[model samples]
Target chain A: MADSIEKVSIVISKGSLEGVYPGLIMGNGARMEGIEANLFFTFFGLDVIRKNRIDKIKVGTVGNPGMHMPTWIGAIPGMSWLATKMMSRQMDKIDIPPVREFIEMIGDSGGKLYACQATVDMYGLSMDDFVPQVEKVLTVGEFYELSAGGEIIFT
Target chain B: MTTVTLAGTPVEVDDEGFLQKPEQWTREMGEEMARSAGIEKLTERHWQVIDFMRKTYLDTGAAPSMRALGKTSGVAIKELYELFPKGPAKLAAKIGGIPKPRGCV
Candidate 1:
């Protein structure tokens, strides 16, 4: 018998470099443990699952309290770009896949990806807008129902 | 704990003969373990894999998967098998003194 988690539901609500990685990495970890993993994407997190756009994700430095650098320096227009590049380079050195490949790997491991219906409507995106790995677009109520009796994590 | 002699001294190991306390593993211990696995002597190529697995485990709390090691450690799977013939991930991690890799069954 396969030792596996019964269920895990992870919420991805932000699209920034820091925000998107947690869900994807944790989802991959869950799938490795033979868990039934469901990743729910909403708001800007929708862009993470959107086809051809996942690789274009950038660092979200605006109003970030952990920016470490001085506020004025972080306010510099190109800082986010530099930070995103550095983050991507670091991830590459560690052999972490880019967002698109990472998401596909999660699917390959039997994890399910779900998009938020409200966000899909707000952005005027259809099923075609998302990568084929996305299993469904669910509402808040549907998500709660589907995730019932499972662990819910908002990242 | 099981014991494997290294340089005439018995070193404690787990049932599989991997060191029970990885931190106490010495170069002689690694070589002793390697020899038992059919690796006669450590080579630059062999060290490439052993060192990579060791360094990666020390740097990160987790050891790299065999897939990740193949991609980033600059060691081919076939060659890794050639260097550590007993079993690649399990044996190399044993010699390298890291915990048994999570994916190794």
Candidate 2:
């Protein structure tokens, strides 16, 4: 009876595990609902699709209030690793896939994955640096063009 | 919630047309629901996925996620989409007379 969302374009800008998963989950959910979904990874978010770094993303224990710990403790060495490990275990229990598998699942479900061309250029990275699921790299203008009639979500 | 007649029997369904009482489902009702979802015919592959979904829901009290379905449904993800276009997990769950999946992934 009411209008339904037909398309969604999500921008992933932060490199932390927390920052990337939200966008991935949203994009995957959109595709599950039969909506056209696009994931545009930019700036630090490029790490998500980076072949070398994607699997190494860690939780930002330091400077993150969600950690619910004293900042000094969070800044301690090995704290982020412990946090990441714990978080990953929790996610695994709930059947959430790891980052690489999640991206592949999204791709398999027909959601588009894109890297920001400007970031790729600035970082001296090439398409080879990205996972194969990344369809292409697009500039800001191209991203806007592709997102023309859809909701743009920045995470 | 609403009640709709499928294959001549009335069943309770949610707003998205997923069955609220999945136990009320029958193969005929599944066929009827499939027709409404745009699958004019339910091939053997469709029944495989639907059977998997229904069995999983009954066993676990929840439908399997798309990833789980792909991993264990004996149907590849790409072909699952081909069998039930658009949203394979969502559409299959609906036509299989199960509640809509609650997970984001």
Candidate 3:
């Protein structure tokens, strides 16, 4: 039965810039293990599946509990921007790959990325707004159908 | 249990673990992990980012964000996008072998 678990599916519901990495990592990791992996990008998660906006996704710092209050307070009106910068800098100092790169890597590695049809309609986004590699825009039920019989991880 | 030292701290390793010492995370090890992740080769730029990530982990005990990573590593945001098309948060964490960071889910 363990060997029969040949595929893995993940659902990414969070849309925040900071919230997108987990799905990316897990999906990519599964693919590295030679497992068939699918990622269902819904709601805010659609931002990554969106072509133009995917690269522009920004970190959320306002009211974020993890933000350093003193540094955030010092930035004042530009705290969000500053926090984003600081976070990126810290990541660079450590050698972690950035979000956009991870997505490309995953796609290049043969992992499938999909957008939610309902969210596209609700957010007024169109097919042109998404990257070329996205397989399709699907509904929750459709995504569930794709994810059935495999591990469905909602990140 | 076997113990290995990391930055002067002793970390216990399971009996069958591959990393019996902190230094076991060698360039070869990193290269293999990168290859497994579908990165065929490691350029100086890749090593630069990876070394920085490791150092940052030693210093702060957490994964840094892309913006912060850029500032400290002198890698421009745009270039970062070029280097890590998937977004720095995920790729960096993956290469660093760290658990997914908070808020990334």
Candidate 4:
């Protein structure tokens, strides 16, 4: 019975390049615990499932809370590009991988990754835009059906 | 609340949500996480990233940035990506058994 209750589902809605990691981590963690895990990528979150752009997603440093204070502040007035470059450079200095790699890792794991149908339509993104491994393009209600009776996490 | 000792001090985590005692997160857990993340073996490179992440968390009270991890581990940016497809934060948080990080929220 305890094993039966181990399944979990997660909904990922953040479109920012930086926001994708949480969903990937949680989904992978659930699988590690022997829990059935599914990830629904909606709205901008679909960027992660996008075939080409997924690997190139960058952290948004201008308004991101994690950026260095001075750079973040300076970026307030036409310095956003600089901030993005500077932040990217700093991240490179440390050895953190890019955002796309994380998304790919989540897919490489047994976790199911889905793209939102509505977002796909709105963005005029075709199936070709998404990675070949994506489980499907699903509606919100469909996602809810998959999430029923399981932990529903939004990341 | 259940109290688990870390560095000789008691750390309280919610009884229900807590996965295990901090020290009890053994090599098995690490291996399990690695396998789930599609990593086949636990190599010295993996340990380098994990140890750096832990130390960074301890020092700044925050997860280490990718660049910081690269600098500390001497791993190239591209290679780190290959190692952790979900990036450092995801891999670190999963293996470290820390809760979802704040910024990630």
Give the winner by TM-score.
2
Ranking by TM-score: 2, 1, 3, 4
Q: CA lDDT of A40 in candidate 3?
A: 88
DockQ value for model 4 = 0.11
- Candidate 2 falls in which docking quality class? medium
lDDT of 1 by residue, B1-105 (tens): 777776677777766676666677787878887887777898888778888888888888777875576567898644655565444667778888777777521
Which tens-of-lDDT digit does each residue in A1-155 have in candidate 2? Answer: 48999999999999998888999999988988889999999999999999999899999998899989999999999999999999999988887889999998888888899999989999999989999999999999999999999999999
- Give candidate 3's error at residue B68 in angstroms: 20
Q: Tens-digit lDDT track for model 1 on A1-155? A: 24435789999999897889988888866654445789999998988999967978988777788767777787799999999989889887766777987887666556789999999999899999899899999999999999997889999
Q: What is the lDDT of residue A115 in candidate 3?
A: 86
* Cα displacement (Å) at residue A15, model 1: 1.1
For model 4, what is the alpha-carbon lDDT of residue A154?
Answer: 83
Best candidate according to lDDT = 2
Instruction: Point out where model 2 deviates above 4 Å.
Output: none
TM-score of the A-chain for all models: 0.91, 0.98, 0.85, 0.76
lDDT of 3 at B66: 49
Candidate 4 per-residue lDDT, tens place, A1-155, comes to 13455557787788655577667767755643446779888887888788777765655656566765655474566455565466557754544345555555445545688888899899998778888668888888898898888888888
Candidate that beats the other on lDDT, 2 or 3, i.e. the better one: 2
Which residue runs of candidate 4 sit more than 4 Å off their true CA positions? A1-5, A66-97, B1-105
Deviation from native of the Cα of residue A67 in model 4, angstroms: 3.0
Location of the lowest summed lDDT over 10 successive residues in candidate 2 chain B: B77-86
What TM-score should be assigned to candidate 1? 0.64
Q: How do the residues A90-118 of candidate 3 rate in per-residue lDDT, one tens digit apiece?
A: 86455445667667666765678888888
